[model samples]
Target chain A: MRATYMFGAGDVRVIDVPDPVIERPTDAIVRIVRACVCGSDLHPYHGLPATAEGIPMGHEFVGVVEETGRDVATLKKGDLVIAPFAWSDGTCDFCREGLHTSCRHGGFWGRNGIGGGQAEAVRVPLADGTLVKVPVGEDSALLASLLTLSDVYGTGYHAAVKAGVNERTTVTVIGDGAVGLMAVLSAKQLGAERIILMGRHQARTDLGREFGATDVVAERGEAGIAAVRELTGGDGTHTVLEAVGHMPAYRQAIGVVRPGGVISRVGVPQYEEAPIGFGSLFGPNVTLTGGPAPVRAYIEPLLPRVLDGSVNPGRVFDREVGLEQTPEAYKAMDAREALKVLVRP
Target chain B: MRATYMFGAGDVRVIDVPDPVIERPTDAIVRIVRACVCGSDLHPYHGLPATAEGIPMGHEFVGVVEETGRDVATLKKGDLVIAPFAWSDGTCDFCREGLHTSCRHGGFWGRNGIGGGQAEAVRVPLADGTLVKVPVGEDSALLASLLTLSDVYGTGYHAAVKAGVNERTTVTVIGDGAVGLMAVLSAKQLGAERIILMGRHQARTDLGREFGATDVVAERGEAGIAAVRELTGGDGTHTVLEAVGHMPAYRQAIGVVRPGGVISRVGVPQYEEAPIGFGSLFGPNVTLTGGPAPVRAYIEPLLPRVLDGSVNPGRVFDREVGLEQTPEAYKAMDAREALKVLVRP
Candidate 1:
């Protein structure tokens, strides 16, 4: 089997590797059918001193059960499934509360002896608790959309839900990447009346409009806030979806959320500390929420929409690559040459 | 007119001051009938170099309107009323959303050229919006409870409501001061099934139990968190009411809130920044909300409870003083000799 390994900053290679096999009674070996390079993956690829050594790389994948351990009962050989960005033992208190990212017995792939999903074959632990089976023989576009359910799309849904998006909500989705675009779609699905997409990219903004953005603010910083204020009648938005983790993104969310409104931040925060004193939140009474999404919990609810062909989030994949081209996929995304890349194993 | 002034840290003095008079078309002059030394008032009494010059002090008071400007239609001479911690125009977008603290034309007492409430007379701007009229005749106890509506009790109610407390919720209220005890009462009124009061003072905790605290954790720091976890079967409480602005109180609230739970902080925030990174809130999906209570907004809803004898938040006051002894009231509260003190002007 061929597997993608990131050795260091700006380094990615697809090399022939031993096939994955079940190592525990609750494990299963999955043959990867579809995978993708996530925006967060760029963090390590661009350079992470803590991750100096080469390691197995992906967390999002759609696959088929090649084999299951003796204890696996819910799934069988040849079953199609999708794994969330992180695996969780679904029976824990956190998982029961729909917070799988905080599961007691599960952690992220690419580390902690767990196998990455960006390979021809990989081992999945806690098989019954982690994997969600999908319908067999889906079209390529639908497959790409289903692949997003593993992480990005579900994450956007989580942000919109946390921000309290609904028919009466007027929202502003920060950022214009794949996740941000998906947030506009999710907010629309949740019945938001107006969605302001704050992005500088013309192509992405056009796509955002297609995804249900009622307005677009291309300015950055205070000017961006002024633009949103102009759109919201100078009162600010009812919900601010913070899909970018940068300080400026958060600043925009805080600035534009109306008094008593909310800011749901879901971009894997980059700042270690944030000012949440009287001036930032208290005076206006803003609710701040969001984190790594419980993709496992969202997958079931969003599957019906993807199946019905009502939402085509896969339109975000502007480029596609084979397993051998994984390294170049990273470069294309890093250089902003591709919106997002769909990879085939 | 007599007014209480804080000359410096631990220095409170009562002195003669000119009586307040209406100066604006929307202004009304009110004679103080009742005022209290709030827990937060101690912030300035115990040293606010910024407030170094002795100024009339007090932001919590119930009064009788003695005079009204030509434009003041809602309030008139000899009307009984209560003022929130801050005054707003009541017509701003923020005021319309029940976030009066952020009102564009409003500001807190004793700052921004506004007159403080703890004096023989007070000049209230935006009288129609700032004052909530009370029934002509009520017992001192009811009046005291209504006084709490101006700040303390309303603040606790804000904390509980923002934390989303309800019949199905379990709550943990940090601090055992007047506000914390009131939070216990507010949570009970909100139908919280279980409420934990965290405080080291047995007397305060005893009052908390009377106010509806189902459990009490006398620990602090990590041990406090462990105790709460143990109480909730190692899962933590569903809602945390942060009524104390101290670092440890905020930390305990953040540490004990269950995944997908909320931390509503109504304490006058003392910290400028908080860590909301991956390790703090991003992974578990916690929501944070709350600030200065929109006391004016809550007054109408909570007044009926006080009127029908369903709640007696005035029990938080353990001492009584006259205008001449207002300085002693501050000393008593600051020394912890009294939980709270009420002053009659």
Candidate 2:
């Protein structure tokens, strides 16, 4: 089977890889129908160092179940399924509470020993717990939306929900990436009265406005905070969705949120050490919550919305490519030429 | 009038000071009935650079209203009251949401130009908003309990509540100081099924057990994490209450918390930065929420419990001293000779 691999920094290639087979009693074999180049995937594509000689490279995919292990009770062969970013044993305490990222037996795809999801076929461990059956038929137009459930959209939704964004809330989304754009949509869907999208790119900000951003702040850092404050009449917004994991983005989120408001962060936090001291954040008593999205937990509830087409998060995908074009897709996204790139197997 | 003053690090003395009078239309002169040294007070007592030639100290006090400005509509000249650790205008949006600590016009005691609560007499700004009327007449046995409302108990309760401690939760209280001990009591009051207190001191741990800590981990750092994990069947607690603001304490709070769980921190955070990258905490998706307690917001709801004697959080007080002996009381607490010191003015 052919799979995408990052040989080194700025080096991505589609290479032939051995087929994945069920290695555990709880495993299932999935034939990938659609996959995408995730923002996180850019980590290695930038300079995280090659984790493996020929690492399989993706964690988000919608596929058909080709086979299931004997212990897989809830799923069967031929089922259309969406795999969350990580695989978890359904019964762990954290997983039970919808926090699958911390599952005791859970692990990430394309990392450690697991095969990546961006392939012709992949083996999914803890299959019953990680795979969500998409009841609808294989509708290609809906593939982008379904694939987002595996990570980005679910993550953005988690950010909005965790921040307690509601009909009365005014939210500021920091970062204009697909996840940030999606967060604007989620905040709107969650009934935020006003959404502020902070980004430098007019094209992205335009899409963000379409996604429900009432205003756009094109500045970064201190300037970004001033912009948000000005937009909010100097009181700042009630909620901040941090979809950019850099230090400046985090600081801006903290700076622009109103007193007692929350900063829900879902950006793949790229920075180390967040200074939360008495002078900066504790005095005003801000609530900080958000880690990885519990995609498995959000899928069922968000599925109906995706199916009904009330939210077509697929709009974030500006470019599409075939399996053979995966390497070029990575470059296009890395160069900021594509909002998000979807790939067909 | 006499008030406690911090002349330098490790120096606390009761010094003669001019008597306070109503300074604002919303001000009320409070003749302090009781005051106490808070754990945070020890911060300055230890090494926080002294502020002035005569800096007034303390932020936890219960007092009788000596006089009220005409604009102080809610407080009377003779009403007994407990002033929250901070003062705020009741009309601010943050104050209305019960986040008085973040009120636009709010300010903490003993800082800026405002007088500290731990004084013979204090001119409480925004008296109507900061002072919670304790309807009943003075009861000596309840003095300690009422004093706790000014800061310690309220802060502890805030920790438990922020962490979502409830009947179904298993909580771990880090730091067995007055606030941490109070958190144990608060967790019990909030209905946590199993409460774990992490402290190395047997004397403090004994008090913690008395305050409803079901288990005590006499370890620090990794050993502490292991102890908590072992106690919770290797899964860790669902709610971790962090009452110690030091770095190790913060790390332990993050380490022992269950995935998807919350770390409610009310300790005066002293650290400069917290590493929250995908490697450390983001992947596990822990929720960090807490700060200085919004004591004003909690006082009204917690007052009845203190009055009815259903909860006696005041047991955290272990020594009593006169206002003139405030310096000795500070040393006693700093030397770990007292859990808390109640001062009679």
Candidate 3:
């Protein structure tokens, strides 16, 4: 089987590797139909501690079950499914509360735990809880959208929801990447009246507008906040999604929200200690919430939308490559040549 | 009229000042029966920014309405009232949404707009929305407890409520000041089973126990968290009320809450920036909320309890002094000789 591995910073490769087999009773072996690189993957590719050592490179995927272990009850061979980024037991107190990411036995599919999806086949732990049936006989185009359900789309939605995006909200998303673009779609779906996309590139900015961004600000820092304020009648956006996890972006998200507004930060903060201005937050009374995407809770509802064609989040896939081209796909994504790179395994 | 003013750092003087008159059409002039020095006063006493100049001090008070402006409809002369630290018009969208502190026309009483409450007479702007009638004829002792309802007591309740304290919760309060001590009482009222008070002084800790702290932790940093963890069977507290706004206290509050727990921070953050580990918050799913106490909302319910002896938050005041002795009161509070200083003007 061909699989992707992070050799080091800026060193992603696709090479011949052994196929994953069921090592645990609750595991399932799935032949991945589609998968993609996540924004989080860049953390390791850029060489963060967790990804310093070469590790499996992908988590989001839709696939057909090739085999299942004895304890796997609901999943069987040839079942089409969407596996969330996190694998859980599905019955823990945390999982029951729909916080599967915090499940007691939960593990991220790729970097830290077992096999990931950017391969021909991979081992999935807690099959019953981790994999959701994608309704048999879904189209290949639908597969890409369902593939997104495995991570970014769900994460974007989670960020928006945490920030309390509603019909009356004016939201400014602080990134024009795939997740940020997906956030625009989610905010629109959730009835955000105005959506602002912050990005540097013209192409991605236009794509954001197409996906529901009511405006775009090419500037960064104080200038960006001024632009956002101008768009929001100088009161700032009611909700701002911080999808780019860095100091400047985080500050922008906090700065561009009105008094008593919320900043839903979905960008995985790479820094161990980000300086937060307590005075600003306390004075303006802003609410900050966001983490990893709770994909399991979202996959079910989102699947129906994808099946019915109400949402077209798959349009984010600007580049499609074969599994053998996984290394090139990572490069393209890293160099910002592609909004999203989908791989056919 | 007599008033307390901070001529500069370490200089508090009780001086003869002109009596406050109804300056605004919506204003009311009140004879302050009782007023107290607040933790925020220390910010100016220590000479921070705009407050470095000589300024009237105090934001918490219980008083009798001596006069009302032509536009005041809520109260007449001789009515006892609890005045919130913030004055709002209550006509703005922020006020309608119950965020009176963030009202467009809202202003802080002592430091910004209105004169300080630690004076014989206070000119309360937007009196109709700022002052709550103290159940007509409440006793002076009850009024003292009600006086705290103007600030710390209500702030503590706000912290507990924002932290989501309820019947089954185990709560940790991170400051032993008046507000922190009141938080212990508030937690009990909210039905929290195990209230842990974090303080260093024996007397304050003893007072905390009396105010419903089930346990006390005198340790400061990691040791404090370890003690709290041991108390909760290694899960940490369900809710953490950060009544001290300093960085260490803020970190302690964040460190001691369990996964999915809430941290309600109400203490005025004197510093501009503090380190925020987004990864820590995101991985654990902690909810952080708080700011200025929504005194208006809680004052109504709390007024009855204080009057009827159902609550005795006034016990947090360890010393009573005349307005002329407020400088010594500030020194005592700063030196930890007093938990709270009640001043009679």
Name the best candidate (by DockQ): 1
Which 10 successive residues of model 1 chain A have the least lDDT summed? A45-54
Per residue, candidate 1 scores C-alpha lDDT tens digits across B267-334 of 87777788877777776788999988998889999999897788889899989999889888888888
lDDT of 2 at B33: 89
Docking class for candidate 1? medium
Residue-pair clashes per prediction, in order, are 0, 0, 0
TM-score of 3: 0.94
Using Cα atoms, each model's DockQ against the true complex is 0.77, 0.72, 0.55
Candidate 3 lDDT over residue span A202-280, tens digit each: 8888988988999999999999999988888788988999888878898888779887788887888766565444656
State residue B317's C-alpha deviation in candidate 2, in Å.
1.6
Candidate 3 lDDT (Cα, whole model)? 0.84
Name the best candidate (by lDDT): 1
Could you give candidate 2's per-residue lDDT for residues B1-345 as a string of tens digits? 888889889877788888988777988999988899898988878786866785789899888898999988888988999888889897888888888887888888877667776678898998888888887666657888988999988899999998889999999999999999989999999998799999987888898898899999989999999999999888789899999888899899878988777888899987768867775567677778888898888888888889889988888888999988989998999889898999988
Q: Going through the candidates in order, state the TM-score of chain A alone for each one.
A: 0.97, 0.96, 0.95
**lDDT for A143 (candidate 2):** 84
- Score each candidate by Cα lDDT: 0.89, 0.87, 0.84
Error of 3 at A217 (Å): 3.4
Please report how far candidate 1 places residue B344 from its true position, in Å.
0.8
Q: Which stretches of candidate 3 lie over 4 Å from their true place?
A: A48-53, A200-211, B46-53
